[model samples]
Target chain A: MKFLEPGLIALDVEAADGAAAIRAAGQLLVDAGAAESRYIDAMVASFEEKGPYFVLAPQIALPHAKPEDGVKEASVSLVRLREPVVFGHAKNDPVALVFALGASSSEEHITMLRKLTTLLNNPAHVQQLKDAPTPEAIGQLLEATTN
Target chain B: MKIICVCGLGQGTSLILRMNVENVLKDLGVSADVDHMDVSSASGTQADYIITNNELAQSLQGHAAKIVIVNNYFDLEEIKSSLQEVL
Candidate 1:
């Protein structure tokens, strides 16, 4: 469904809390023409209620909100933190990659999640993603997943 | 027929797990219907079992379905074995 567009990359962010992470990701989504400006609040609220859901996976976070929460399009915003921010999960590791996802519906979004989960489960791929410094590099890494 | 409801906090991951489960079942020649439910709205449903991760499965404490903890929803091998046990 072409959610992660060419412009959905925010190189380095300096977010201290979950709310700040949502703001940074929301801005990227808005800039990418994926979501409206109002989606920032919805994303924040969703995170507040359910948290980042990082689970046992350290250094990675999947930030998403419901479809009815002002999603203009299905898209993903890739954020690399300059430093790590703790989201109070059991893993207690700083988040390096925050993938802000916005989907049109639950079913449609699952396809993307399946692909993303496969990528995340690979330690080598996750390490490459963390080491990638430029947006273009991150795009290349994502492209490799399809191969 | 055995039913397995796959759910996450939102419906996205749950739906993905449901699709994968269905595909795995089809390949195994198993007869079952997999359903997708949001973790928040999964109460009061009747299913043979619930297949989800540890966190989401904990939320379905009062459900009628037997909870089967799936470490990774995309792990076809794990999901297939778990479903076979339940069936």
Candidate 2:
């Protein structure tokens, strides 16, 4: 199933820092009715609590929080920053893409993550996502890559 | 064999790690049950190894399972090399 939608993507957004970047992505989930507003705070706080472990790859940050932390639905959102920001991760920093994910349970999370991991493993695809000019472009890219 | 992928929240990052660890183990022809959980829950869980990042590995220092610190959750080569040494 196609879970990620064009409306879920926010391209070339401006953020002062990593927290704001996360907020930009997380806010999209909230706006999509996938999560409560506080879910965004939980995602931001998770970075502070655990450092940049969520910065899974160079130029990529998958900011997320627990299902119990206000996730109303299982969903993912994308936000590409106009300017990359450092997440303080030793290796992966200056993150350019923020994917804010919210899951109501592990089973639901596993389904979404399988697609996410596959799409992210290819650097070309990552670059495509980064260079995608519009939300529809990003959505089309993800749809084309799904297993 | 059993492995638990852990993180502070035990939801996003750890789940990603768990999937990679499962993949690495499969590549090595090793049969193992992989799980993911929060740090607090990890302390009470039974596992042969607890795969976690460098920072979360600190609080998990005294857990029964051996701690394997992975710096990058997305790097399959890094995950495989680290798991090979201990597994």
Candidate 3:
């Protein structure tokens, strides 16, 4: 029941800009075999087309593209940036955490999203995730969140 | 009550907003049927309220449902205060 794997998790990654951060997150999905390389391009295109609407919370972002964008599996990659980067979101700027979603279908994405929503709704759990020391710690935090 | 959370992609951020809204409603002891939809399908959908970000709020103009612009999608207090006026 683990949506995040240690290999796909990056803590305090350094990026030049928001796009770089997104690319780094997308790379995790690529490395995990969840998504193809074009999926990263699609994510960037989606961000350009949709603006900062992907910033779901004050310090969190959920970047994704259409399922047709080249998803090979249903999963998500977690990226914690060393320094927050701005994605033009007026209210929620300088995002520190990025959750890149890659799903083979809408249903798969929705199912994963429901679990994510439950985990993120609790501020305490979110703080735990943000302050997690290692990828193992992050995985443990997510494990505690699963019902 | 019926509420539809709208976002550009619908499945990603909208789902989170919908979850948050549902939690707020439950805390208020109110019953509601909440749904999530993309911006493309949102305008034609039927609902009492359409919750979305400030950007999409403008995009959904002239829609049937009352638009609720939620700036901070995760801010339960802001969402509660805004829903208080309408719900």
Candidate 4:
């Protein structure tokens, strides 16, 4: 299955930092029926404890919590930041995109993580995501990655 | 067999990295088990090696396990080389 389908986008988030973006993205994943509501808090707590590796590359963030924290399903939540947020890492560049993930088990989670990482590795796609203006546009961008 | 423990704030990302490491080990025909531990509990574990990103590995200094800090967990080539060196 395509990890990120059209319904996963929650565009135009107004989070001031990585922590808030994680919470918002987690909530969206829950609302999209991809994860349990409790997973949102767990994801936020992980960020609080670990700082943000989610801020992998410039302007990109991929925040996630553990499966044991309470994941009902496997899915991803995408949020485009209105303004960049500093996550306090050495790569403390402001984060413009947030992709919060939820998985039911370790093996399944890792598979999705691999795909997401491969996607993020593409500079061209990252640039497109940064420039996409609407949720629909973001969805199209993700869909294009599937090919 | 070398055992590598990969921990994150929780075990989520650690587990993902562990799986990737496991795949790398398999391809190399190396005998190893890459396990996941929560960052809180990772300090107490006994392991032959520890593979993690800069942030978490920084806090695990002077542990019994030899730590290898990776720039990104998804970088399979880097992880494979580090594991080979430790083994």
Cα displacement (Å) at residue A79, model 4? 1.3
- lDDT by residue (tens digit), candidate 3, A32-144: 88889999999998898878788888889889887788888888899999999999988889899998988555576667877888787778988988889999998888777
List the TM values for chain B, per candidate.
Answer: 0.83, 0.96, 0.96, 0.86
| lDDT tens digits, residue span A1-147, model 1 | 545555787767888876787689788888877778777887787667765453325676666667777887777777788888887655435777787877677455656776777676567887887788787887787788843
True contacts preserved, each candidate?
0.09, 0.43, 0.57, 0.20
What TM-scores do the predictions have?
0.79, 0.91, 0.91, 0.77
Enumerate clash totals for all models, in the order shown.
0, 0, 0, 0
Model 4 lDDT, residue B43, Cα: 82
Clashing pairs in 2: none
Give a tens-digit lDDT track for model 2, residues A19-127.
9999999888988888899999998898887787788778888888888889887888998899999988777788998999886685767889888888886778988
Model 3 pairs in collision: none
Ranking by DockQ: 3, 2, 4, 1
Q: What is the lDDT of residue B2 in candidate 3?
A: 86
| Model 1 alpha-carbon drift over 4 Å, by segment | A52-56, A91-93, A106-111, B1-9, B19-31, B71-87
Order the candidates by TM-score, highest first — what do you get? 2, 3, 1, 4
Residue A3 C-alpha lDDT in model 1? 53
> Once superposed on the true structure, which residue ranges of model 4 sit more than 4 Å away at CA?
A133-147, B1-5, B19-32, B75-87
CA displacement after TM-score superposition, residue B3 of candidate 3 (Å): 1.9
lDDT of 2 by residue, B25-85 (tens): 9999999989998889999999999998876788888788888988767778989999999
